[model samples]
Target: MSDSYPQSALREWRAHMGHPATLVAILGVGLVLGVAGPFGTDVRLTLLPRIAYWLITVLLTYSAGTLCDAMLKRPLARFGFWVHLAVTALATGVAILLVLLVVNYIVYGWLPDRDSLPAFLGTNFAIAIIVSVVLATVHRQSTPVEIVSNPVRILDRLPLDKRGPLVALSVEDHYVRVQTTRAEDLILMRLSDAIAEVGDTKGAQVHRSHWAAFEHVTTARREGDRAILTMNTGTDIPVSRANVAKIKEAGLLP
Candidate 1:
C-alpha cells in the first residue's frame, strides 16, 4: 500500500527510468557518440575501441546524471521552474562531470592540468545546462497542470509537490493539517477557514476539528454514540453527533 509518500516517489522514479523509450534513448546516444568519436578518440584509437569508449562514457554519464536529477526534481519543484532547472542542472552536472572525468581518465591515462581545469569544467557545465533544459521541459510537459487553473482556493496553500486530491483536514492547535493524495502538510489556518477555502470540492466538516472529502470517504462504522469515518488515506476521523446524518446523506455509510 502507498501509505508513504516516499514510496510513491520511488515507484514513479522507477517507472520513469525503466521506460522502454528511455532505455532505447540511452542506447541510441551511446551508439551515435561511438560512431562520431569526438574528443580526439578517432586519432588515438581504432574504430571499435573508439566506439567502446564513447558508449561507456555516455552510459556512465547518463547513469550519474539521471540518478541525481530524480533525487532533486521533486524537492526542488516548490522553487518554480527556473530555480529548479538551475539547481538540478548544476547538481546533476557535477555528478555527470565526475563520472565523465573518471571515464576520460581511463581512456587517456591522465587528468587535466590545473591551467585547463577552468575551461574543461566550464565546457561541461554549459553542456549540463542544455541537457537540464531539455529534461525540465519534458518533465513539465508530462506533469499535470491543474493546480494553477484549479478553482479550489485551498490548493494555493499547498506547495506544488504536496498538492493533489484532497483526502482529509484536521486542526492541531493553530495549524490545519491538509492531507492530499500526493502528500500532506500543515497550514496555519482555522479549521472553519480551511473548509471555506475548499471551494467546489464536495466535502464537509465531519467534526468540530475535522473535514473529509466526500469521494475520499472509504468506510464508516459506529463506535459508541459517534461514528468513525475512514478516509482513503487510512485516517479515521471521529464524526460528531450533529454531522452523523450529514455523513449518512452523503451515502458514505448507512
Candidate 2:
C-alpha cells in the first residue's frame, strides 16, 4: 500500500516548489489581502503579515512532519497527506500565536486568551488554503521535462557515450509530464516499481504518477497549504504529507 503512490506523490510535491507561478501565488494572496484585509472584512484586515508568517511556519512544520515519515510509517499514514496537512496547519497556527504573544508580552505587556486560539488559527488556515491551492493547481497544469538523450546515464551497464539506451522500457502516467531529450519516451515500468528501483538514486516518489530525480530538483514551492517541487526539467510535482520530509532530507529540495 505504501508503494502504491505515496512515494511518487511525495516526489511530485517537491517538483512544484520552484515555479514562478508559485511565488506569484504567494504574492497574489498578499496583494489581495493587502487590499481587502485578512478576513476580507470591509476594513483593512491586512492578511499579508499573517500570510507571510504562516507560509514560513507551515512549510517548515509540514516538511518536518514529512521528514519523520521518511523514517517510519505511522498511524498518520492512514489519513494520508491530509493528516500531515492538519498537523502543519495546527502547528503553524500555534507557532504564529506563540510568536505574536511573546513579542506582544515583551513589547506591549498584553496577551490574548488561549481560548481564542480557534479563531486565530482558523483565519490563517483559510488564507493558507486559498493561496496554496491556487499555486498547486497552476503547478499541476505544467508539463514535465524528461531527459531522453541522457538515458545512457540511467542505464547501469552502458557508458553514456557508447550505446543508445533502450526505448519504451517503461511507461507510467505522471502527474508531471516528462519530455525526454532525444525523443519523448514513456517509461514502461509501473510507477511504484520504478521509484523503488531508483530509491538509491537520490530521488523520491511524490505521487502515484510522479517520480522526481534528486539531482533534477531545483526548488520547493508552496501553494497556500500544499507543497510542490520544481524539477531541473522544469516540471512541478505535488508533495504528499506522508513523504515530504523524506524527500527533503534526501537533499532533493533546496
Candidate 3:
C-alpha cells in the first residue's frame, strides 16, 4: 500500500511537467494535429508500421514522465496519484501521436490511408497504457537521497562558505525553508537578505516575505487580489500585491 503525504508533494511533478498550463497547451495542439492526420498522404503505411510508430511515441512519453518522476524522492501523495499519473501519461502519448499526425498531414496529404480510424485509435490507446505502466514502474524504482541538517551554521558567524551555491534562505516560524534543488531546507536566517545573496540561481521575491526560485515556479494562479505560485514542491506561495506585476513581467504567470 502507498503511504500518505500532503498535496504539497505534487509540486515537483507539476513543476517538472512545465506546469498544468503547458500540458494543456501540448494536448490542445495534439488534438488539432490528430484529426488532421487522416487527410495526409502518408496514410498508405501498413498496419504494422503504424503500430510501431505509436509504440515509439509511447516510449518517448514514458521516458519523459519517468525522468520527471525521478526528481521527487517519493511519489506525490494525492487521493488519486496513480490515476492522475496514468491519465497524464496517456495524455502525453496522445499529444505526441497528434504531433506526428500533424507532421504527416503537412508533409503529405493523407495519413494511414490503408488503415481505418478505429484501428489507429485502438493502437494509440493500447500503446499509451503500456507506456504509462512502464513509466510508473520506473518511477517507483527510483532511489531517494537522504538529507541531513547542520544546525551549527547559525547567524552567529559571519559566513564561511559564501563561494558555493547561493542558498536563498527564509525563516518560516521555527523552520527556515531554503529554496534550492527545488527542495526546501530548514535553516535559520532572514528571508530579505537571502534573496539578495542567492547569485547563481535566478529567482525573485514573489511575496514581501517569500523568496521563490524562478525556475522552480511551474504556474501562477490569480486568487482575487492575491497571486499564488505553484512551486516545484506544489506548495502555493503567495505573491504579494507589490510583486505581482514584477512576477508577471518576469513571465512567471500565464
Q: Whose TM-score is greatest here? A: 1
- In candidate 3 the C-alpha lDDT for residue 170 amounts to 46
Model 1, 205-237: lDDT tens per residue? Answer: 889899989898788889777899888877778
Q: Please, what are the lDDT tens digits per residue for candidate 2 over residues 1-254? A: 12334453454334333335545555565555445433323232235554554344444443433333322223333444445345544444454445545544553365557897677657755655554444333322223344454433334322122122222122333211232222222222345544443424556566545666656656776555456776554456677767677676876544
Computed on alpha carbons, the lDDT of every model, listed in order, comes to 0.73, 0.44, 0.50
Model 3: per-residue Cα lDDT at residue 69: 38
* Best-to-worst lDDT order: 1, 3, 2
lDDT score at residue 202, model 1, on the 0-100 scale:
91
User: How much is 153 displaced in model 1, in angstroms?
Assistant: 22
Clashing pairs in 1: none
215: Cα error in model 2, Å: 14
Could you tell me the C-alpha RMSD of candidate 3 in Å?
Answer: 14.4
Whichever of 2 and 3 has more lDDT, that candidate is 3
Cα deviation at 239, candidate 1, in Å, is 14
Query: Worst lDDT window (10 residues) for model 2?
Result: 159-168
Q: What is candidate 1's local distance difference test score? A: 0.73
Tens digit of per-residue lDDT, candidate 3, span 2-51: 11233333443344445444455555554444434333312754455444
